[model samples]
Target: MLARSLEARGAEDRTDCVSFPRIELRLGKQRYWPQVLTCKLFRWPDLRHLSQLKRLCICGRCGRSPADSITVCCDPYHFSRLCEPETPPPPYSRLSPSNHWKTIDEPTEHDTARQLRRNEPSNSQNQDWPDSSALPSVTRDEHWCSVAYWEYRTRVGRLYTVCEPSVSIFCDLPRGTGFCLAHLHADGRHEMVRRTRGKIGGGILLSKEGDGVWAYNRSEHPVFASSPTLVRGHARGLTVHKVLPGYSLKVFDYQRAQALQRAMGPELPDGPFDPHSVRISFAKGWGPSYSRQFITSCPCWLEILLNNC
Candidate 1:
């Protein structure tokens, strides 16, 4: 391909020239989990032209710049010039036989069950949860009604589907000491928030001042949050806010309260102060994994539904 490219150019080119056909690789039936490395090249016209002063044929086509581009990521052999290592696969467990593989086709029943089983609880939550009847009955006068709740989006603890089903609910939150939920620990202790693994953090505290909720990044790493009531509303669908460590974001969207407000509680007459239905998602890194994260929400306002309002 390089010889053909140079032949096609015919002469030394000064411009940032690049060409490649669409490349696809097929590895029999089980190729999905294997790492497919593609080297990325940058065409820095000025630098290569300068390097040409040494009479070096760095470039294959024009001999101006090197034909190879510096790689910034993912190609395992990238670290060194000659001694490159092999790219590894996902994990022994994730690999499946042809019969077990589920691509664009319908998943078999075993596949579905295997997928769902990944998000089960990890550690243990305190036993003293209020009964369903007690949740809706709690009043503004009671402190419990003032708090919010979070429910894991996927039964398999979607952040890392290969892991066990993690913690389900967090209850009895006080006005202060906002809880921090994160995926910091590498070992088994990741269930501090809700018994899940590989998740971002959220240190959520109810606003002492107003209906607002103040969220801080108590974890070592950064966290992202988003909601329909948030600045980048979910009407556009799945936007995000990056909340750095120690920093906080004021999250109170009374504007889009008509639909979500019903879940918050009947404190106001459908005007301001949307209830606990604030649904947001978090992840350790907002990559493809972000979509898999638990779509957690404040369960505090579930009382409104329990009241049959």
Candidate 2:
């Protein structure tokens, strides 16, 4: 069975489509289709029918070419299941107030009271400047207003404050950056560097924009990210999003965080959950889809702890 599976996979890799010998699969009295069985075995185990999956254009046998007689491809990787669409919030009302008119000679008591208050010194105007003691003293790091910081497995780095709009996090780039993980002497830094020496070309760029933090994947490999903002709708499981090279994604959304904060509860997944922190793994993805289950298990992963988020 293993040999046949391997042969089928090899043939599929070489060509656009490859067929396997038909085998009858049954549970009790009910029989399952070959396509459904293949999808369940390879793609999504919870997948029940072939209708749940959509074939990719790369699959030559799957309705792309008019000349081709084959309509379906049993290749599980060539098909992807549809995801539930997110519903947007309702629109606000635009109803205006009723208009009123009055004669120039008819001055009401309300108008006289308003003019009296307007001429009088207001409470705020009376206090021209606040007392020096009332104001909070600025610390050395106050200039940088650090919203977040990065961390390895156990070793934590300095607070990632940004005087500028954005900052670049790299491994061994010559240019200056806000934070350089390559200089840090973490436990698995050497191993991660060794594994992704040449592949870690141009690390990711993090920018603090309006109401959100964006992560641009400048590296060659994909970057996996998981945060409260990212997994706001998914209450049952943690959702890890993969950002391909050159692609950018909002890792942290303040507006979404505020909305989820009130509804969020203590019930979480098996691993440790830091509601204010975001975990990003470089080159490797660690989640339900990948071999590594958590970000800690990843060779090179970063934990971004947000402040006043």
Candidate 3:
């Protein structure tokens, strides 16, 4: 009865009208009907028809409104189920090893405020050092700050902020413990100041703990007397004596490295060297390739060894 009804609907005249045969024929040649359909439906659909099918999906992880015509939650793992079998994975995994994993060795959580350690040698180790009164104070205070997960950008295409840490909200975080210094762009110069907080982790500013009674030093980084702004009911600013020595090299080490390289010439390797590898591998097997005379003297080459430790 169904066949008769289909036949009566024009029988021979409607033979070409049957879409399944045409689809099978195209598919026999490995043609992608569903992809063609999707591209037609999405990329070139009439605006009136397109508007009816368009939808906005929010990412479960990020709460972002993805493109109107695309499936929002189509994770790479589930792509096979999202469309007909012919569609391949999105040609790229943003998290793939070749791309994002190349620089995974470096840390994203850069403590910009950390200073160099005082005990570490600023000059050669054998040289006589100045007394405690003669040497300068290298300490700096840490302040607490955490960004909400929603606040961080999805992708950073630029150099500086490319490796920034992901932020998340923590309700039960510890109160009044951890602190790190951050350099904020103010006035003309990058001034160093100490800040404290009621909460330990996460990047939110709080108020100063005490009244505006802080000491000033003649030889240290300029101390600021003003109070920082607050978030919630907490004070984010406190007076810290010194940041670690690691933070100290962040400012001036690059310039010093370039100067040392020019003076040493090709006698030393052009850049930082792995001292442990030189000590273990080169000391045993390779001689001319990794020589001892060049390895010990170069400070820039030596520091990478120190940094590795």
For model 1, the superposed segments whose C-alpha errors exceed 4 Å read: 1-140, 143-204, 231-235, 255-276, 280-309
Which portions of model 3 miss their true places by more than 4 Å? 1-30, 40-101, 108-309
- lDDT for each candidate structure: 0.26, 0.48, 0.18
Instruction: Candidate 1: count the clashes.
Output: 14
Ranking by TM-score: 2, 1, 3
TM of each candidate vs. truth: 0.30, 0.48, 0.14
Q: What is the lDDT of candidate 3?
A: 0.18
For candidate 2, lDDT tens digit of each residue in 1-309? 433433453222223454544554687886666666776876467777644554432345533332343333466544444321221111111112321111011111212212222331100000011111111233444442342222323434554565544566777545445566666554544565458545555566665545466666656677767666664333344456666654456677667777666666564333333455566777776544456655555666665655555
Candidate 1 lDDT over 1-309, as tens digits, reads 334333432122111223332233344652221112222121111221111111101122322222253311222111111100111112111123431211111111222212223532111000011111111122343342121223432232223111110111112212222232232222222253343222332232222112233343333344444433442222222333454443344333333444555554654322232233233333232212333322232111101000111
Of 1 and 3, the candidate ahead on TM-score is 1
The sequence of per-residue lDDT tens digits that candidate 3 reaches over residues 1-309 is 223323332111111211122131143544433323442333334212212221111112222233333332212110111111111122211224423211001112221112112212111100011111111122233212211110011111111110111111111222312222121122322111111111212221111111111111111122111111100112121111111100110111223334444654665221222111111000011112222122122111111111211
RMSD of each: 22.5, 22.3, 26.9
Candidate 1 has a TM-score of 0.30
Which candidate's TM-score is highest? 2
Estimate candidate 1's alpha-carbon lDDT, on a 0 to 1 scale: 0.26
lDDT, residue 91, candidate 2 = 16
